[model samples]
Target: MRELLYEILTSAGRRMNFEQTARLGNALGGLLWQALPGRRKLAVEAMVRHLGISKPEAGRLAKESFRHNARSFVEIMVTQRMDPRFLAEGVTFADPERVRFLAETKRPVIFATGHLGAWELQTGSLGAFEGKRKIVVVRRPKDQALHEVMMRLRTRPMVDVVPHRQAVMPVLRILRKGGMAAFLVDHNCTRDEAVFLPFLGQTAAVNLGPALLAVRARALVVPGFLVRAEDGRYVQHFDEPLDTASLEGERDEKVQATAEFYTRAVETYVRRYPEQWFWMHKRWKTRPPEEDGQPRA
Candidate 1:
């Protein structure tokens, strides 16, 4: 079952849904079943044996898995479009003229976002606010096919992408030339390098790249997001740059505080539309330190 699950996911030309993803989860159950050699899928077995759920009731829930996957996929698609009006239907920016402040600035700026709804759409939406400076999309490419598909969807007059790894040199060159380099550092894979901060009412690991860049390049570090609204229109949010000057030399304190600040800010946006947030990820997988310097489990 684990082998089958791996094959299915690795299979090109296959799009798995929530149901399929859960079936993969169930395949995890199948591993357990194989060890036991006497059980059905875990969810079914749990509902029937442990919870005493009727066969029909358990069957109904087993079928709803794709709902979770589809919702997740669609939300990501929102950020891939250039126009919010087209993807979000009713969403619009409160103030776009504000971007001139970012565009006209001679220094490079770092835009920080997370794995929130259709965030790639941000580079496209930046077109409305763009002057002459081009927006470079920095991402770790997934696959050749998906990369091309993403390129087609995200490329526009004002926007282009450079793979995140290759981006450092190109981005630095652009920064030297006063162009913007944008990225999301919500999930860094190092300890002490990134601080564990609260998001969605739990501890989340956040990277210090934004602060590091803003400090090194003297670029404005603007925390931004596409906050989902009650009207179902996704509003573009541009938080004024953090006061990094006040945080000078005391970078450790600033990095810790700034990460905490954005974590809360992102949490606020997530609370606005709880369903739009990616709840499936183990965002709280990182445990809070027992003490400030104590290693997290």
Candidate 2:
């Protein structure tokens, strides 16, 4: 029954032409985003502080961001019904050699990126590039039916999605086989599970799971970004891999340093593609303790 419902929803999404669907999704989703008082306030405040812009500019950016984000989400749902080759044809990689070499290497690698651009396409692009080689992606679980729908939307023949809590073994197995794993590391984390790092000029809580896994698995940590080009195409950009040698002493320090390093990498891309990063989520929900002894809420 759930699968049938999902199929019906997806079929409805696919009924519209690509451009028409994108336009409708963007216009309707942007309006809905603006209607949500809580999310609208959060996005406006974040855009203002993060961009150091006027309230009006922040409002404009928030509106555009919502439109682009909605268009992307709708595109993902609609495009899932299309063949992977057709989808792959539209995406271009900034450094094909880097992506090829990394994906083909015998050494385990950790591919890291934030929720920028059409991130769902990143999975497909990697899958297309890697061919039969598996790409394991760590994801937080959603509600059961929605989770099933998302996994269907995101997974490709060469890409596998693993829930975060149970990802350890599968990730390790893949790493041991010299495979790659990917993660989106920009979400808020509980204080106990995250390390505080500078993100867009403010100290924000960042998950250390990717870094910790890299340290433990001795994998190369590569940061990547997917951004929409001015020409209406998507570009997948890969940066130099992170060196964890400086983080070799204590477990906590290694984790913290890795978190900071990757967070900075994410900040770089976010700065370049400011509107692509998801601003509706409370990225700085976790706060540092007060010097006067009162705990932060």
Candidate 3:
């Protein structure tokens, strides 16, 4: 049943009649609501209130989302990419200054991102640069089939793809060549190396990749996000660079401080659009090991 629905929706992407589209949107909402984590149920419910959907409908929508989420990450991004119209009508990407820099920069700056809103759509703005600047995105490999599709999407002249494990040197090389690389720093893969920082009033394990690279390369570390807008347009928000040269210290301290700063920015942004952020994530994966122990360093 779900596969049939996906096939129909995929086929009707830009060809659906109004009634069919409305029905799909309603189904999509149901899919999303089901996926909401218990911690994020309030956020989902709040969205229902704001959108004026019935409580029952919201609950149903959330369940559908949880189910739909089983689709490959590339599939989700592709769907979002096809609907660039979403950025114009249903989403908001909120940065003006940093986006200007991305297009006009003499050398590339690293954009460290959290899983907030429709982040992939944020690069739609970069597409305008054409040959002048290239955007390379990092992805963790899931399976061979999904990996190939992701690579295909990244093959456009304006974009590049790098696997997370093998991406570091290549990413630096991109910046070395005056192209930009976006890194997602919200997930903490190694508990020992991550620092627990405040996020949505709770401690969340945060990664420090973007900051360290910014410091090592002496390049500006910019925090930017793409958020889902009400009218379907994305508001890509680019914040001014957080200077990391100031944190001249050992590698460990530098990484930790960087984690804290980015998480704070993420927390601030999440508060502005509480429901727009990806809260279902186990952001607070690392906690103090003992009652009196300090946050993992």
Report the number of the highest-lDDT candidate: 2
Cand. 2 Cα-lDDT: 0.75
Model 2, 1-297: lDDT tens per residue? 877887887777767755676678678767878588788788889988887888998888777778777777777665454355654666677888987787666777788888888776667556544543455565656668877777777776756788888888788888777777888899888877777777887878889888888888877788877787767677888888875644568877777777777898888888778777788889987876542365532
Q: At residue 5, what lDDT does model 2 achieve? A: 88
Ranked candidates, highest lDDT first: 2, 3, 1
Clashing pairs in 1: 18-65, 19-65, 19-66, 79-118, 79-121
Q: What TM-score do all the candidates reach, one by one?
A: 0.62, 0.88, 0.70
- The C-alpha stretches of model 1 lying farther than 4 A from their native spots are 1-91, 132-142, 188-193, 230-232, 287-297
Indicate which candidate wins on TM-score.
Answer: 2
Query: How does each model score on lDDT?
Result: 0.54, 0.75, 0.57
Candidate order by TM-score, highest to lowest? 2, 3, 1
- Judged by lDDT relative to the true structure, which candidate is superior, 1 or 3? 3
Error of 2 at 88 (Å): 5.8
Q: What lDDT does candidate 3 reach at residue 20?
A: 45
Local accuracy of candidate 1 as per-residue lDDT tens digits, 53-116: 6877654443332232233343333344345346344456655665657766676776777656
